[model samples]
Target: MPDISPLLALPGAVAGAGTTADHYGDLVAEQRMLAAGRAIVDLSDRGVITVTGPDRLTWLDSLTSQSLATLDAGQSAETLLLDPNGRLEHSIRIIDDGVTAWLLVEASQTAALAAWLDRMRFMLRVEVADVSQQWATLGQLLPVGSPPLVEPAAPNGVPLVWHDPWSAVQVGGWQYAAEDGHPAAEFPAVEILVERDRLAEVGVAARAGELPVAGALALEALRIAAWRPRFGGEVDDRTIPHELDWLRSAVHLSKGCYRGQETVAKVHNLGHPPRRLVMLHLDGSDALLPGHGAPVLHEGAAVGTITSSARHHELGPIALAVVKRSLDPAAALVVEVDGVAIAAAQQVIVPTDAGATAGVPRLPRLGAVQRPQA
Candidate 1:
């Protein structure tokens, strides 16, 4: 039988197996590293789909949540592919390189998305191709400004140029070319991928060994802390874009018609979303926090459900909850998972106030005070 050990190693990573995923044993070692410290995750497991041709921009704009027309060269945006019923099929990062649009998404979703897009193509001139094998995906966190960043040369090459607050970038493919006196003839242009490989090169001495594999647990924790919402957790068939606060990142309201546009507009202009996403502090040991879909209770009533959970080394356990907007943030809630009661406290990370909607919070104006009549 073909060696199945490499796959086994990933789950055994928490136990400290080995340096490389050279075999099943090594993968186990990799997993341990990922859970404990910082591990450079080879996101090759993710997928890349390229959309090229004259109608690429227009075609994408008609489908996704973000405004594509305004996406200049070297910039990128996160968008969602939603079913006609408004359920999320996948969450994608759209990178515009001035030549082609590249979508980064879960590997499992790639084939389905490509097929969906192909079916929609009638008179619109566009070509969709899966380029997963041609590209290698890498991720890492590194000190900012380690190397002077260069923009993608191709017009449609770079997408979403803004820096992640954590100073990481998800990039595709690595090229080797002759250049000035650098140790490596060619290095990864993307910061995250470069950092990961650099860690591998230096090994334990450079703190590479300390980095743990960022499993789903850790990834969920980081995202929840950043107040980012995942598509599958926060979105569904009944959800409109505005309901999940997606308008802040996705959804160009001014853009012309697309599927479910009517419901999105009507809900935003005429009413408030019935449910909202919020962060919760789960009061318990790391092991007690409920997993996803666990019910949230307020007093004796069921208020909402837990969408995600994570155990921070410093903060104990925490979770993201979807609850009724009318539910008081001050109200006490509990997450009961597997017979363990995890206490929860709600926090409004994304404010629903009108003042916040206007833009940056305005500070009080200070000027010479005039004496007022008593």
Candidate 2:
């Protein structure tokens, strides 16, 4: 949101044009660069908040969805800040450096989230500051097929990095995505902190072929293909982590009390999420792309709406949608884009049966005292 025009005016690159792109001319080439893990994306649209104080870690653990009280230096985790009524309010990508906890959030949420955190620091030794104006965000992928998990080293004197944990379930975390061969297992994503003043330098270096640079568009396509959940797009005020399969990495099931923890436990253990997430493989052979909020239909009835849709180089146009949990998994669906119906097939990311103790016994109905004879 700062004066990034200088960065955009560099040669051989196309302007981002709002909420998309930081690419160097060719979209396909930029996408290839990202998929190969050879390019960095200028994710400056994200914001950073710094939490400094002795009580930072413990205080965060007591208020968020993830357990952070024992987190060590340079470690990463994703946590959700839910309302008291168990609805999502914010999702934070977090990492600590023993002295500071850096929270990476959407730019729109930066100041608001920081202000809220400050207000909640009653009688606590914690200080929250929106550092987005001082720091920027950059994204890159870890080495493909690397056996050991890698942590991103600070770049350009910026000393924080938050590695994405969506690739697998963390200890004490629950996974609502019941499908076999989850696509995120291969999404080796990492986000790094960078000084704001280095933006033009990065753009210049990228233009001179000294460093590879792509755009947010490429990364988003891969994210959709991988079925990753994101804030502002995949989430809303009514969203619960279980609906997005976010429990896999963000919610620690056995963590001590926090806002919305009761709803998380009850939904996972005894009740089912009211809705479910699914990947829609759209019929884009017609070159039609569906926009966000496009209706997803089954037999002429609107069952859901497209949250995020993208045209990946390899996968073409694909989308992620949230539909009623009772919608039949095998039912053929359609997405309406520009008044044309695009046929879609459901890839069961979160199955209808997703929940803990799904097979647990249930009590008999109140009016039925005895079993009826067959």
Candidate 3:
């Protein structure tokens, strides 16, 4: 986990007594600011992989599910790394600094992914290096055109965009990016390292100038509303990228060969994905539901399992579940937590037909009302 102690001094950071852990130190303080929307989270827990050398673009294109050739210096994309069986290995954000490319992934998977990439470098002329510590990352959702130099791409087909300090692209929404120092000759964005203690100062500066600091919980809520699946929670070696509705943002059907190309094309063109990811509105408490592997039942029969859960103050207990695709969305299901059946209503957030099937609603806008439980 990223060190968030720097956030403690920020206004409205901790609402109560804070605790420290071996991994996630000062989580209580982080959670409090996250709940109240008054702090900016240091997303340095995300690992960064730098792809340099002349053959970087071609090398990456042949290795991932997305089309790397289309990305320019100021653009970014969400792509997936798949296993031999087309199972999800990682969900990554690909940022191009004009010359070199950077891959951002969950911290825990950094070493494994780095090793895997290194092993696959058969005379590709690409150098893969871990740059996680050399740089710091922060994310915030700003209004369209709020930042002067930011490129935006809505990978999930939602209103939100991935903003960075680059020439802005007018996708569905606006995203802004800012770097600390001058970017490399090929990369256009500025790159700088802000000290941990200076994050609050940056936040204060941003707010004073009209930019608001959005915490992790709020970002998670935004992701849930957009139906974006997290890697560890909704994706794993047991499931393919299509099962998690990642095809829209991560996997490009038209991309060239990669590690899991065969299985991906086979399931996509010929077969239906067995399990599907769905959003659930829990009826009962504001507390979070059991996380990954928790059972979901219908009339005492096992139906599916909970993958991720969060306590949204406005939405009560909300969760994401990977259930049998054949199960009716309107059907009432129960998430079994500690032998207790917690009522959960399902909503198909990502339509397999990409809006051709009109059963599910589109991603909600910021501050939209929660879907009422039946």
- Give candidate 3 regions above 4 Å deviation: 1-5, 8-39, 148-212, 285-288, 350-374
Residue 241 miss distance in model 2 (angstroms): 0.6
Better of 1 and 3 by lDDT: 3
By the lDDT metric, which is better: model 1 or model 2?
Answer: 2
Give a tens-digit lDDT track for model 3, residues 1-374: 44543444445544212211111234444444443434444454567777887788778888888778667765667677877888887777777665567777777788888888888788877888876665445554433434422222222232222343222222321111112221111112222223334455665664464433444555555455445578867875688766666665566676668889888777766566778888888877634467678988988899888887766545667788888877876888888787777889887753343212223456789999898889
Tens digit per residue, CA lDDT, model 2, 71-183:
98888999999998788899999998888898999877887899999999999999999987787778877665542121334632335767799988899887767557788
Q: Which runs of model 1 end up more than 4 angstroms from their true locations?
A: 1-39, 83-87, 141-216, 350-374
Any idea how many clashes model 1 has? Answer: 36
TM-score list, all predictions? 0.69, 0.92, 0.72
lDDT of each: 0.55, 0.82, 0.60
Candidate 2, clashing residue pairs? none
Task: In angstroms, give how far residue 316 of model 2 lies from its true place.
Answer: 1.4
**Candidate that scores best on TM-score:** 2
RMSD, every candidate, angstroms? 11.5, 2.9, 12.8
**lDDT value for model 2:** 0.82
Top lDDT hit: 2
- The residue ranges of model 2 lying beyond 4 angstroms of the native Cα positions read 16-22, 144-159, 356-359, 365-368, 371-374
What number of clashing residue pairs does each candidate have, in the order they appear? 36, 0, 11
Question: Roughly what TM-score does model 2 have, to 2 decimal places?
Answer: 0.92
